[model samples]
Target: MKILITGANGLLGQKLVGLLAEKEVEIIATGKGNSRLPNPDTFTYVTMDICNANEVMETIKTHQPDVIVNTAAMTQVDQCETEKEACWDLNVNAVEHLIKASEANNAFLLHLSTDFIFDGADGPYDEEASANPLSYYGESKLAAEELLQKSNIRWAIARTVLVYGIAHDMSRSNIILWVKNSIEQGKDLKIVDDQWRTPTLAEDLAMGCWLIAEKQAEGVFNISGKDLLTPYDMAMMTCDYFQLDKSYIEKVDGSIFQQTAKRPAKTGFNINKAREILGYEPHSFEEGIKILHEQISAQ
Candidate 1:
């Protein structure tokens, strides 16, 4: 099988490439520019912008891939609030272009989404729950989902949360990295005690994506981690796991920090859909942190 992955240098995309490298499939990876990742000899790279519909179509036509996994997005929550047009263009418009290209090339498209679509009014949302996005970033992702549903193409949407792990050449700035950096630098870390999510490890999420692609599972699926915790709780756990000073971590309410984007108070998701359909059993938050610590130690 010939597979093409967008955003190949990203946290999740790089992990996916590593996982798929052992398989018999031929992989063609692409990013916004000339960013390259450490990979096996079998893999190939292309630098193409997804926003250019004509260029995207031409590339898809040339590659003739059987599957296209799209992980590209403007995921900065605060930035999306101010740069609404750019956010929509990258998240929504670019996805539409990819969907059209996938249809033309007769390829199955697996698009990565986020758990931010929930308003946080509810504690934990299932796949059947309706999306009520609180931020422009979430709204743009939801709009992309709507477009995918309307298009006459083979597609699957995976909604994930708090993804963190090793990347190829790009720097990842997730909650895990922030806490690690603070502890390593002997600096105090202030984390929000109210905001909650099921922090997923990028490696586990990559495996789940491969399963979904292999099964050709269509429709929406919540592929988040099993455990849920607030940012403060996650920081404490990370400190404990790494044998760092707990005094360096402090808890702060979400309202204390003013931001352009409104974060969901409790946006944890229930991954029963993934568990039942894809047989996906994600690691707990503690296990994820332990793995992260080990990966960091290796570097």
Candidate 2:
């Protein structure tokens, strides 16, 4: 199968590229910047700014891939809150471009969504749950999902939460890495106890996307880690895994931090739909930590 993946430099995109590298498939990997993937021969790299409709059209036409997995977005919650126009452009407008282009090309699309679409009034949502987003980021993502539903094309939305793993030259750090690094360096860290999530392993998310592509699954699927854990629990687990001093980790509530964006108190996913329909099973948080450790250690 021929696949075109956007945001190939990001965590999920890089994981998809790596996984597909081992398969007998052609990959067209596009990112906003130069490709950071080490395996040059694994996929063809294309520089694309999806917000530009022209670039989107050109990239889609050139590849005409059987599947397009769009992982690109302005995912930083605070950044999305501050840069509303930029967020909407990337998250919603670009999706419109992709939907039109994908429909024209007859390519199946597998788009990524987040758990933030829910207000966290109640959590562990399935695909059937109603959305009531509180933040601009969540609103933007939900808008994109709405667009996909309207577009008369084959598509699937894979909603995940707290995706954590190592990627090549990544600017962001996952909770496990952050906790392990901070504690080892003797830096005191304040982790929030109020917020809870089913922190997804990046590999598992990539696999979920792959499953969507391989099966050509339509509609929405919740693809995330099975364990619902608070940030404090994650920190403690990270400390335990690394045998680091947990004393440096101070548990705090959301009240103390003055974040630009309002975070959902608890947004976990019910993955029974994914498991039953796609045969998807995610790794436990501890296993995810161990896998992350292995990757970082090898690096």
Identify the candidate with maximal TM-score.
2
Off by over 4 Å in 1: none
Off by over 4 Å in 2: none
TM-score per prediction, in order, is 0.96, 0.98
Residue-level error in angstroms, candidate 2, position 220: 0.1
What residue pairs are clashing in model 2? none
**TM-score of candidate 2 to 2 decimals:** 0.98
What TM-score quantifies how close candidate 1 is to the native fold? 0.96
Query: Candidate 1, 142: how far from true, in Å?
Result: 0.5
Q: 21-123 in candidate 2: lDDT tens per residue?
A: 9888899999988888888988899999999998998889988899999999999999999999999999999999999899989999999999999999889
lDDT of 1 by residue, 1-299 (tens): 88899988888888988989988889999998875678447588988899999989999999999889999999999999999999999999999999999999999999999888889998688877889999999999999999998999999999998887766653766667778787899898778888888888898899889888888899988888888898888888877777778888777898888899988898888888899989999888888887777877777
